[model samples]
Target: MTSLTRAEIGALGEQLAVEHLRTLGLVVLDRNWRCRYGELDVIAADDATRTAVFVEVKTRTSDRFGGVQQAVTPDKVRRLRRLAGLWLAGQDKGWAAVRIDVIGVRIGRQRTPEITHLQAVV
Candidate 1:
């Protein structure tokens, strides 16, 4: 069997996350939106709450050291907060709510991607 390349793994994880969000009825607006300052993986709208969601996708092949969610530390949250704010500021209008989310993905041989949804990660 061929070991998965980093890009392939990332693509799989992102695809899964997007699919899951769509299944949950969120309207996907953007993917991999980046600027010179930072990156936002996925942007979606939760119509139920009339809110905007900015997602960060974290992928891991193994959890022996730490899980994917563990990688998001306080520093990461701070950066995400700043980036999200920057994104919001650049937009034409404002929403009632804004959220920062993290999607944890773990892929392994003979198994599908394991996912963890962390809402309001910042």
Candidate 2:
């Protein structure tokens, strides 16, 4: 088997996160939406709540630095909130609610990948 590069692993993690969201009945709006600030890993609408969700995905090969979720610091949360507002401002449709989410993906050798989703991060 071949080892994956950091970018490749991150892409895979985002893909997996999208799949997980779809399974939860959320419709994906965009992926890797970027602007001058930064990138939004995933944007999805939750039909049940008529809410827009801005997702930040963090991927890790190991917990050497910390868990993937730990990467999303207070500063990162602030950035994501700003990006979410930017996204909403550019959209024509108004959402009843908007929130931020974080998806952490951990990949390990010879094991299935682990995924954790935290909603309303900010």
Candidate 2, after superposition: displacement of residue 52 in Å?
Answer: 0.4
| Candidate 2 residue-wise lDDT, 12-114, digit = tens | 9999899989998999999999999999999999988899999898887877878756888999999998999999999999899998988888888438878
Model 2 earns a TM-score of 0.95
Q: Considering summed lDDT, which 10 consecutive residues are worst modelled in model 1?
A: 106-115
For candidate 1, write residues 6-108 as lDDT tens digits.
8888888898999989998999988988898888889999988889999888878877758756878898888888888888888885688999989888888
Regions of candidate 1 where Cα sits further than 4 Å from its true position:
none
Q: TM-scores of the models, in the given order?
A: 0.91, 0.95
| Candidate 2 Cα outliers beyond 4 Å, as residue runs | none
Whose TM-score is greatest here?
2
What lDDT score belongs to each candidate, Candidate 1 first? Answer: 0.85, 0.89
